[model samples]
Target chain A: MGMTFTSNVLKDGLSRIQREIDAAFDAQLPVPDDMSASLVEAMRYAAIGGGKRVRPLLVASVAELHNGSREQAVRAGCAIEAIHVYSLIHDDLPCMDDDDLRHGKPTLHKKYDDAIAVLAGDSLHALAFDLLASPEMSNDPAVRAELVHALASASGHKGMAGGQVMDIAAEEAGGDLDLHTITRLQQLKTGALLGAAVEMGAIIGRVPSEGRSHLRNYARDIGLAFQIADDLLDVEGDEEAAGKALRKDDAAGKQTFVTLMGAEQARAQASALADQAIGHLSAYGSEADILRELARFIVERDR
Target chain B: MGMTFTSNVLKDGLSRIQREIDAAFDAQLPVPDDMSASLVEAMRYAAIGGGKRVRPLLVASVAELHNGSREQAVRAGCAIEAIHVYSLIHDDLPCMDDDDLRHGKPTLHKKYDDAIAVLAGDSLHALAFDLLASPEMSNDPAVRAELVHALASASGHKGMAGGQVMDIAAEEAGGDLDLHTITRLQQLKTGALLGAAVEMGAIIGRVPSEGRSHLRNYARDIGLAFQIADDLLDVEGDEEAAGKALRKDDAAGKQTFVTLMGAEQARAQASALADQAIGHLSAYGSEADILRELARFIVERDR
Candidate 1:
């Protein structure tokens, strides 16, 4: 069943979302025939042709479960992906993570200059909110406002960015961070955006806050499993398959789930978490099959 | 009358807005007792106790002219100011403008490390939309969405960031950019946000798109005058009073309004534009007196 799910539903969803995200960015950012052309080009270069499109997939799958509009879900997914891509671009900057490769291509700062990279990242950050707030995202202004608020809160200082600060500090702390500290860091850094991805789908589905506990729990579990799997990948996964540098955590002496727990324990923990994540959706029948498959894939996939 | 306006109304308005913006940042971003403290501190450092608070003042004044609530206008103003402050932080990065001083102090990157500066700016960028879409900004969701849309549009690739690209291109083109191109650059770079400042205020007051022509014209005229005055300041103003490095445009061999038209002509154009900006507000009587004074003050102020 897991193999069938990966080859069918999840595969179809990923490809469809990848195409939708590229098309959305292509349509939204037409390079002007003027001096500012390079800025738009840089934005397109970084945004249009990259990444797993996982956030969009999550939004689409969750929204589908709720019988929400596919178009609106895709649009919202694009907004979330924009924020994700922008964060990646900034994180790869020379002063940040100093990454050279992203999605098997040169990082934005390496491809363009640092100034263009910064501006492009900033533009994408603004573009996310613009996409969310635009009338085309949803006819209902309340829905649009809610979407903007959710993305903004998740992306801001107390969420993704704040988590990054903790990650950096963890690196400087020389791998002394405990399990609780590291878990808090990952929750803010990666967990907030992932949680928001599920929450946003629920928002599109008109699911109230009080009714989203199961989905939230599912997201939380998957988020940690995803991070733990990423740590395992850094230690054992192929750089070619990952399409980027790996083992940098060990080089930087950063304390990660694998570093603290050892690979065997971390891998076991990830599998357990993935199973827990899948169980959270027991309330639904096969309608949540893709989500359950996603949980399995999170810990099982090479990348 | 102009003297009375500046010393009384505008003066009070400026100080009041400065306090409001500072207080808003202080209240919104309390430093956490953890590793993320530096990130929040960096955001607060750059956002508080800086600049002229011109954007906030514009929002407050225009919203008042439209009989909008003071508190709501102030909140919206803080959002605009956040965007402005974030732009400044990014612009001052070593990879960008490489400036050392801003608002009479070390730039964000100079004060904090480059990575923190980048994250702080990105966080503040998210914070702008967060503030705009928050329930406190407006009771009507449509209004909050409109505010977010207006700001996001003004700050993205085709707007402020786009203008920055053109400005960089102009520098590479070696002071040969035509007046039309320069005007277009300034329109996007500075004019867009200035225009959005008034547009947002009108949005807060529930002014429909069709009803904002006069205000749009008022904003447009003042926007140009503001940039021209900035160019003049860069040429002849005291760096001490300006609180930033001046004459750098000339050093970079960039074409500015003053460079292209000569200081005398640029000064004349700015004064004319200011008058033209004030003339657009002729529909209102004493209710617009502050705005009229602001227009005059735009071209007349030394820094």
Candidate 2:
């Protein structure tokens, strides 16, 4: 019956992974002088520009709990973040989400040119696969393969792409859509990656298969909750506080949980999902406390 | 000297892989009963549309040549093509390359909205990784890991992105770039993937380290030759023949080999490179005949 919010609940994990990602970006930069300048700029822009390092931190914490070495966990975390950052860069292109604002600043394409943004995103994606398959993860090939599969599934169409397709279709249709359809679309598009983050940590940690199943379930619940909260935020959040536009969902003629089920109901559902997600942590004992806090953080964040 | 143009090189391979990719797409499609009409149309417009299937075919061919089974190679090839297609979609975005043409038709974003283009590209990317890591690649953990590493490196900042960066910067600088710089850029941007294609085949085939080295070298040379020929075509070929605008290099202020060395020299260089690439196949004897033919095909293509 007791839950304490540790201000630095995942600080060591976050900082360590952030440091690793920073080093990777740095090492990858100052590329050969003969290289294209746009590519160099794009890589630097996508990899180094500041953002909340939440995903990387989550990976590290989950890996640690699953008994993976910090070194391995941190590297995997960095790899996942690379994928995340890459997706954002591509998403922000004038063609995709077309938003100028990301994390309260210009998206990569906006800051650079569209070509750089596209190339940068592409490179980040490549970097992700390389890092996972690198010797940094483990000498054990099985562990490495598991991690690769988990990451790939999250990044690709059946997961993220499938979700995106659904969202686009929904938008074009531009009429009343049921909450179920919206949630399903969000789950595939956004939830898949988030869930994969947690699941990948378990895979890398070599957690028992049964325990991995429980952790994935935990991830799934929170991932959905995270999306629902995001949808709610778009409706209720302040633009400055959220670090992006508000009510743009309505502007886009997109249907969200808030639009389909009303804001009050969406809030209730998100809380319920978060609580459900946290409940699954009982299976992990104290090892999963950090994860529970992360679930709460997902819904609580304004930006 | 005896080369007949037969498009059926990977015909069997393409048919098999194409079927799989189509199935994957079908399984992922939102049931028509689930949403409004426009969203489904956008999804279909992006995913169901087609291309020449070059990237995947390369993967399958390379993988089979090295040691892997045709079936396995086909899957890997399809995955690589997905990544390539994803890149093309994003690159053609209005914010990026902004080309109105693709595969002799309107680009994805042109047919659909910018948002759909972005999401589709992203989906394809995620799908590629998923395919690489899927059970289809292998039950063997080490093989899957190898596949992931090969594909990721080709796609990432250090490889393709690095190449793209060099390309954009050189173009923007708008001056005579040395052969070394230009070659490096072209190699990294285009050759890297081609090299990766060959490498993926080697990994799938479980080719010996030495053989892989030789194969990779051959692939790099051929890849560059392919690009050089492409540059030549832009300068000399008809727009209708090329299926896109010609003389884009001059218009974009880009520095191609032709721009640096002039037409005749560039043509001679390409021929020399193609010969060098063919020479690498001496070790494989008849096993590499198709590859040898491909090398010739690279320079011979008018478009």
Candidate 3:
């Protein structure tokens, strides 16, 4: 791989997606001049002007590889990002992780009251499906339905929320979990949405299920690699650079890849998984360069 | 109206929908014997064997009026009911209503913990969209997409959740709201979902937006009447029969219909609204009898 080219593509792609994601949210969540104004303001505070936009980048890149429209993919990406943002808001509530900071600022619950935070999170949750089911998502009703199904399945009890349940349970168990259990938990917690991002892109491209095996494999590999990288970052990264609390896993005594496998081995594993993820896209040419570079960046970036 | 005949239809319809809604939840939320077991258990606990199933009943009754398939309507009803139930669960959280009892039992957060309660509520919210987007909801993808769209729009910030924000603000405002403002607040908080229930049924029955004026009117009237009746219940009805806290509006110093208008006037207003709601269904004679009786039952019910 050409290091400079990969760096440029990854950096430019990240910046472009960050802009688009913010713009999409700005367009969707206009605060009404009413009692709900603060709620929408909280949603805007949480959604816009922050985050890495990694999920949206994945959705756009995968969609590009499959020749999907940029506009539709961006819309779908916003839907996915809404789910991610809402989860974070709720996770930061006093009853949950009890964090006071997110994205280098006061968390939604801290900025607003707990009730506003809860309702804002919920409003965003509903907004995800609303965006997906809208006519703007796709001209074909089947496509919109498929997108809603993919997202809803990834978000519900059997997926992201369920993973959260396992996470809380694992914490209660004093982090005495095996590697397999931790892997499953992360897959449910973070991997499900990552996988859905890719799957929704395929659906947008009208790619059949059987034809998406390589993409699915690519998503699966990167999902695990992403979690391992996150674990490593939590252990070694700076809070200022990460823009959120670091060392939380260590402080909470939660089982993570770095704890279970050690930093050195975990780093190696993440690299190998990223390599495997790129390998899954071997059939595609330069059109998939962004995705390939994204895989590499997943393990290489500081945050 | 024939008194006995209307009463029988209303009784049978409510019971049937109650059974169907419970059965649908039972079939959907099968707990996995894993770390997430408690999460799913909390979901099942919050979802099944509770509530009046009024939303689902509205969906079924409206769908029946349009001659839509019973099974499909029941499925859509379940989707709406899921949204309703999730809202109730979140509304009962410590940061929100701070209620201990719901449906004559401990609230989910009280029974389990706040984390479980939050995730369970979120899971069910996603499940509502998942169920609507599923093939089982409708043979036509267009219908499925429309159902998701309807439910999502109704439940989001501009609708039910937005209404909740206003409700909270009203409480903070020391119950000084006028009748118009309170009416608008109640419309969004409760009327949106009720209106969506009827609208979704119309969509399932293949009624276009232009042809839905009468049904929409009926829904709007009943929605307000339902809230007014609820206020009456809060003031005068027994907690044992109502299955939850009562007189919360007075306790919190929140403005409600009963506070803005005297009890006698509010009762008369609800009764008049119910009559007008039934009047909107005049075009459909015996076919909409259940709906008509339902309008009557809305103001007349003790709990």
The candidate maximizing DockQ is: 3
Task: Name the 10 consecutive residues with the lowest summed lDDT in model 3 chain A.
Answer: A1-10
Docking category of candidate 2? medium
Worst 10-residue lDDT window for candidate 1 chain A reads A1-10
Please give each candidate's TM-score: 0.98, 0.89, 0.98
Ranked by TM-score from best down, the candidates are 1, 3, 2
Model 3 CA deviation exceeding 4 Å by range: A1-6, B1-6
DockQ-based ranking: 3, 1, 2
The superposed Cα distance between candidate 2 and the true structure at residue A111, in angstroms, equals 1.8
In the range B1-303, model 2's lDDT, one tens digit per residue, is 534434455345456556765565555455455433334455445555365555555666666666678767766776777677777777677766678886577887788777767666766676667777766678887888888887788777667767666766777778868888788878877888888788878878888667577777788888888889989999898887666667888899888989888989988888888889888877776666667767777787766
Better of 1 and 2 by TM-score: 1
Error of 1 at B147 (Å): 0.5
Tell the DockQ for candidate 1. 0.93
Query: Candidate 1 - CAPRI tier?
Result: high
Q: Estimate every model's Cα lDDT from 0 to 1.
A: 0.91, 0.73, 0.91
**lDDT score, residue A194, model 1?**
92
Segments in model 2 whose C-alpha atoms lie over 4 Å from true places: A1-3, A6-32, B2-67
